[model samples]
Target: MRHLVVPFALNALRRGRSIEQFLGAAGTPEAPGIRWAELRPTAEGFALVVHLAQDIGGEGSYDLVEFPSFEREDGEEDFGCQIAVVDEPLAALTIAEKRLGAGRDRWVNQGMAGDEYRDYVRAGRPPCLSASQSEAECPET
Candidate 1:
């Protein structure tokens, strides 16, 4: 997936404004519809991924915005410097880790599980592909 890093100013979200209100005041069209999932602290300030209409011209535009964080001393504002946009799950995972320090344990566990499943399918005698097959019957990778 392509990763695009851009600058964004998101002082509004850091100011305790709801995601909807922030997006509304940020000039994002309401018709396209905006939905917030969660906020994770990134290297800059915070990372916010909002799902919007795919029909939008910049369907996957990554806009970076600076926002104020309470952690700063003297009420200093933290700047959001980088924004990354990507479509691949793996790429997204990597970006998340680099940008937000997100843990990769979950992703690693999922990959291991998928590998085991594939190995079982490929090594089974007579190749049992049915989901009803007993785990004992499947060969280990």
Candidate 2:
């Protein structure tokens, strides 16, 4: 089994839902098992790197999974999983994409702009800032 880096961003795991739950929800029947290595918090949010054993068939076929922290109906901690189509060598790209997707939404909703906003995106090390940037500023990158 090859070691595939599965990037995920989650809360402190102190809540009722843990990373394991997120993985189960995101994983497909064919998906290989994952072993989490690190879960670090960044300026934007948390960063998770897990070693998984799976066969990534081809480009655009691999699934990049993410689980963002949320609150459960019972006021307990919860998370929701999201999946994305990714290319080969999924490690860095998966993390970058998750950060971009999550960060972009946060920025747009908060109306963040200027250098501070730029720095925020930069911190995530996104694969292609242009693709994740807002329509107005995307062409500038």
Candidate 3:
């Protein structure tokens, strides 16, 4: 995992200060379990996109996971896992999750972006989240 995580500092933000390096992992990019995931820059923070099977009896599609990020005094962040895939465009959707992770999560048809997503994130590249996930936390030269 070190080979893949040496670049991003998400762990820093995900669990506060994370200096430990993952040295063991077993899989190739060609592996079947390798799901497609990408980070999207949003005005407030970032969103995740992954291509995978939708659900039971459902075909695969791009699932966007938008976890509400909240920082704690202990340095651990809450990654609200409420997952869902807006069948239509992001703009035309509204998502709501139950508190304490109970009940079913729902989304309504609505537009999230009036024009585009960048219009929300200050119009430039988002700053590095943390040192572990810092843009500069790269491997040795």
Query: Which numbered prediction scores highest in lDDT against the true structure?
Result: 1
Error of 1 at 9 (Å): 28
lDDT of 3 at 131: 22
Q: Tens digits of per-residue lDDT for model 2 on 95-118?
A: 534433223122210111222223
Estimate the TM-score of every prediction: 0.21, 0.17, 0.19
lDDT of 3 by residue, 1-141 (tens): 222232233333233221111111112234311111222333433333322211111112212123223333468553322233333222111221111111111111112211112221233312221122111111232
Q: Model 3: residues >4 Å from true position, as ranges?
A: 11-34, 53-141
Candidate 1 residue-wise lDDT, 49-85, digit = tens:
4321211222123221211122224464423222354
RMSD of each: 20.5, 18.7, 19.3
**Each prediction's Cα lDDT score?**
0.28, 0.27, 0.23
Worst 10 residues of 1 by lDDT: 18-27
Model 2 misplaced regions, further than 4 Å = 1-69, 72-77, 90-141
The residue-level lDDT of candidate 3 at 6 comes to 22
User: What lDDT is obtained when candidate 2 is compared to the true structure?
Assistant: 0.27
Q: Which has the greatest TM-score?
A: 1
